[model samples]
Target: MQLTITYFALLRDQRGLDTETIDSPAATPAELYTQLAEQHSFTLPSSALKVAVNDDFAHWTTPLKDGDTIVFIPPVAGG
Candidate 1:
């Protein structure tokens, strides 16, 4: 299935885009992330990334459906 993926902060810089479309064979958020990271060579610790599905925060085991909007946010820091 095809899902829309959005990258924030450091992830966007590394990926060179804020949003993209990804195709995955798995049904959960974690699976999709694994697929994307492998496909794009994005080196990020899974524990350091937050995921949102369809604009709401989602757990790794959250089920994914066609056309779901998924956003990946990396850890943020401030002074």
Candidate 2:
């Protein structure tokens, strides 16, 4: 399946790109992330990241369908 992935804030800096299209056999958010991390040579810390599917916040185990738009938002810090 093919999915569109977006990186925000620090995550975008780590990836060096704002968005990308990924191909994977992964069904859940966690599995897809594992594949993406390996392919992109970046570590994605699940505990510190928030995931969104099709513009809505999603759980780690949320199933991903073809053509889904996924976004990874890293933890934000401010005073």
Candidate 3:
């Protein structure tokens, strides 16, 4: 199945991409992230990030379906 992924902050800089379409067999957000982290060498672990599906906040274990748009939001430090 194919899904769209969006990255933010460090994730975007690390992967050198803000968005991508991926073909994956990952069943949940966590699995999908692990796959991408390995593929892209994303440094921060999922514990330091949040996941969203279809523009709403979602759990890491949220089920993924084809054409789903996923966003992995990393921490943003602000003063």
Checking candidate 1 for backbone clashes, the offending pairs are none
TM-score of each: 0.86, 0.85, 0.93
Worst 10 residues of 2 by lDDT: 36-45
The TM-score measured for candidate 1 stands at: 0.86
**What is the lDDT for 65 in model 3?**
94
Q: Candidate 1: which stretches are off by over 4 Å? A: none
Clashing pairs in 2: none
> In candidate 3, what are the lDDT values of residues 1-79, reduced to their tens digit?
9999988889989989889998899999999989998998988999999899999999999889999999988986889
When superposed on Cα atoms, how far off is each prediction in RMSD? 1.5, 1.6, 1.1
Per-residue alpha-carbon lDDT of model 1 for 1-79, expressed as tens digits? Answer: 9889888887787788988887777798888878778877888978888888999888989989999999877876868
Instruction: Using lDDT, give the best candidate's number.
Output: 3
lDDT of 2 by residue, 1-79 (tens): 9999988886677789989887878899888877777766766577878889999999999888999999877777869
Q: Which candidate is the best by TM-score?
A: 3
What are the per-model numbers of colliding residue pairs?
0, 0, 0
Q: Which model is ahead, 2 or 3, in terms of TM-score?
A: 3
Error of 1 at 35 (Å): 1.1
